[model samples]
Target chain A: MIAKLRQVMLVLAVAGLAVAAYLTYVHYAGVHPACTAGQSCIKVQTSQWSRLAGVPVALIGLLGYAAIMGSLFAPEGEESRLATLGLTLVGFGFSAYLTFRELFSIHAICEWCVSSAVIMTLLLACALARYLLAGGPAPESHSSRYSTGSSGRMSA
Target chain B: MASRTQQKAQARAQRVAEERAQAQRARRQSRLRILAGVVALAATVVAVAVAISAGSASSAPKTTSVAAKHVSATVNRLLGGIPESGNTLGSPHAKVTLTEFGDLKCPICRAFALGPEATLISKDVRAGKVKIVYRSLCTATCGGPQPGAFSTQQAAAMAAGLQGRAWYYIELFYHLQGDENTSYVNPGFLDGLARLVGGLHYGKWLHDRSSPQLAAAVSSDQRSAHALGFSGTPSVLVQGPRGARTIPYLGNYQTYESAIKAVEG
Candidate 1:
């Protein structure tokens, strides 16, 4: 189950990495994002919130997704799981902030940004579930020390 | 023999209990480490987020009015000898015309105004080889159709044109362009820009800015921009006796210079 979960996480991280990489490319290449939503993408990309401090937000996202992927390849242990959780939590928080800025401050929604935010949200959820399942107490017998029953609650 | 068996069983039980205790201790330690790591990471994320938010706040354009006399002097120095009638600047009989579709609130348009447009005006427009036209396209703000303050400000420029000071007003507005999302195009800001235009008559300009004709002119600029299918601001269209061509993007003044030459031939 842990291996399967790791595979799932790897897939998500790769998807996120692709999105972030594309946005970063668009940023540095000085070309309009391939947007179908009538300049909202352009407006959001050009807004001040598009950058953090001096670094482009897209570059930050790219580095973040890359870090998550790196952590996944580390020795399989509780430490690696925790690292993934921590990184995704941060990404989720920042993605939420950017989404808020798009809706409220910029009054424009970039489809690419929304897609990235969705990917981050899913990654955060998967990381959290993986963390919980990994931290469950080891079973002592067939009955198990901890197991989820029909009620969806952990049982001893 | 039975007593010996009991003794060995007791020792085995003790050893098993000790092993379980050690395993539990290791698990507890690992959990603590993970918890500590999470807390530290969360702190760093919060710190970075706060820094980003502070940077964004500071990045908002400064709205405090610049010194009127200083702005007027600069505007005059740059646009002094040019003839501006309505939205057109340079000699009326100039063979070539370069029309710029721009939004006052657009940062990119502001860059063009400060860089290539400035050079084009000083060299070509001043020398009677070109006449530049200021047309409106709300690329960066105001969404669409509703116009809001974007149309109001564009209409204000058209009104300045009525007094033959459109270029002066356009240059000054771009000089003080603010955050696009901010409501900086109020009456005070518009009047402030107008005051910086050396010879603009405040009363007549104010009255004309609210006129229906100016409003239509602003709308007409939008229609023209749509007709040309311009998707962005500072979209330039160069025209001469040969033909008219719209610039695909804002590259540089040389792009405009070349296009003008192409049409001139």
Candidate 2:
């Protein structure tokens, strides 16, 4: 079940990365993100909130999804699981904030941004479930460190 | 009877071992929950902090009274000698025309106008190598008494053009640009801007701004902008002997400077 959860997370992360990459591309390319819903994408993209700390938000999303993908590949252990949880939680929180801004402040919605947010939320759920599930398999690389066997719990 | 007693004793020991293992598992699960909670709390704090920082950074700076006093003089100095016939600036015979599709309320357009644009006007435009044209496009306009504040504000600028001071009015507008969400562009605000344009006739501007010709001019700008597939403000294009080419994004003065050089060549 834990392995299957990771596989789901990987697929979701890849989807998120593609969305972020496309947004980042359009941002730098100075072209509108392909949008069917009127000018919402352009309105959101050109808004004050589209950037954070002078860095484009799309690029930030790209880097974040990339980091989450990196955590998935880390050796399966408490550290790797925690890393995934922490990263996804952060992404989820930030994406939520952006969505709020989109609805209230910017008054426009970019479909790509909403899609990324959904992916982050799912990744968060998968990470949390993986973290709490016990007695699956020992960390492949850190088996000796577990000491409590397949429970992967610290004896202390 | 002795064998029965041994079996009972073994059963009691087995129960005690199972209970101890269960208690250990419960303790481990509790610890995992606490660790996860801490990690989540910390991540939330970080995310909120970053979001707040971004919000504050992007907030518009209040245009101070002190700055307001010098805006007219500053704009006049920047563009005093430049020719401004209608919406165009610089020599009419200049070989290259750099057209900017902009909205006064758009912050990015304001940034480009105040930054690289000043340099371009003083150097290239003054040098008679390039003529800059302003075409109005409403990417950012707030609700006001006028149903179409975009057309009204732009028409006011076009009205200033009647006296050959549209560039001055435009430069001054960018300098005094406020929060896009605020409805600050009204008759009073428009009059204030027109008054700052050195020698513009206020009564003439008032009458001519509502004319059908200027309204048509603003409409034409929107049509051309839409035809170019531009949905954002400050979409720059360079026209020369070769043809028209769009600059993908606004960069520094160097970016526009380079494009002009390429077009001129």
Candidate 3:
């Protein structure tokens, strides 16, 4: 279960990275995401909220995906698993916020933002399922100095 | 007992090695994350800043005002004091007369009015070298005044003229002119505009604007403009002691300057 979850996360992380990269390129090149016919994509992109703290939101997404990929490299243990789950949850939350802003506040839908939101949602769901099914990291095979007395016993 | 001790020592060494590897991986990850984040942040900032600055630079109000001032100065120097007649204001005896037919509701007319024409008036009219006559042509086809509404606006203009405020009303109308023919020409809007030009007797102006004589004058002007090949709201004819010649008075100064010089020559 744990291995399957990791693989899903790895795929999602890669996909997110790719989407983020495209978004970043568009931001720098001043390209509007593809819009439905006759829609005002330029209006949406030029609006104030398209950026956060003076940074293009697309670049922020890129950094987020990179961070998630970095966490994936952590050793298979309780701490690493929790880190992955936590990072995925944060990404889900931020993506949801941006999606809401695009729909209600901006009144313009950006196709790229929607794609990122969808990917983040899938990642969150998979991460949560893996967390539940795996229970916790497999018990450590060898004892160490940090294992005090009987507490070091491998329960699994 | 000795074998057990040796085994414990080897396990400790292995644990230390794993810890060291973990720490190295963590350091590398942290550095990579920081580098990626900084680059991403810088790129995003640069992109956003460039977009915003470009948008603002084109439409900046200050730049527009500065351009307006320069145009005003040039026109004032070139065409000052031609005469004043009815709605037309300029030096009465100036040998060279530049008659401009314009629609208040036309954007292009407004541009010419507020830009090059303003400069011409100050320079030629003030200096008594050239005369400028403005004949209102109600060409508000899309969003300007209706036929009746233009008569009212013209009447209001005539009333303002009676009060020695023709130029003032013309200026105010140019400044506050609304969309052509759209409901922007309603009585309320006109009233507000009249008040801005100092209240002309609305009743009298309304009556005089429909007068046969004013109608005839407007019709005659329209015929003259059409005969001179004017297809648009702003058709200018520069007539001097030299003779009357059509001048291309587009928005830019180069064409306008050449036309003025040609008329002067």
Per-candidate interface DockQ score:
0.22, 0.20, 0.03
Predict model 1's lDDT versus the native: 0.81
Docking outcome class, model 3: incorrect
Winner by DockQ: 1
Question: How much DockQ does model 1 earn?
Answer: 0.22
- For every candidate, the chain B TM-score is 0.75, 0.74, 0.62
Interface RMSD of each: 4.4, 5.2, 13.3
Q: Which stretches of candidate 3 lie over 4 Å from their true place?
A: A1-156, B1-83, B142-148, B198-207
- Candidate 2 reaches a DockQ of 0.20
| Clash-forming residue pairs, model 1 | none
- Give the C-alpha miss distance for residue A44 in model 2, angstroms: 1.6
In CAPRI terms, where does candidate 2 land? incorrect
Sort by DockQ, top down from the best: 1, 2, 3
True contacts recovered per prediction = 0.26, 0.10, 0.00
lDDT of each: 0.81, 0.80, 0.61
What is the Cα-based lDDT of residue A67 in candidate 3?
Answer: 83
Model 1, A1-156: lDDT tens digits are 888988998998999999999999877655567889866786787666787875889999999999999999998887798888898888988898889889987788999999999999998888888887887777665234222331243243
- Tens digit of per-residue lDDT, candidate 3, span B1-265: 4488657865876787698668667866764575455445544554554456335322312212454445434433433333446766766767677788776555456656656676667776677777667776656533333666665565555556665556655665665554342445566655555554433566666566557776566667777777778756666887765566775334334455556677675
Worst 10-residue lDDT window for candidate 3 chain B reads B56-65
* lDDT (C-alpha) at residue A104 in model 2: 72
Candidate maximizing lDDT: 1
> Candidate 2 — which residues are off by over 4 angstroms?
A134-156, B1-25, B39-43, B46-54, B57-60, B65-86, B98-101, B106-129, B137-139, B142-179, B184-265
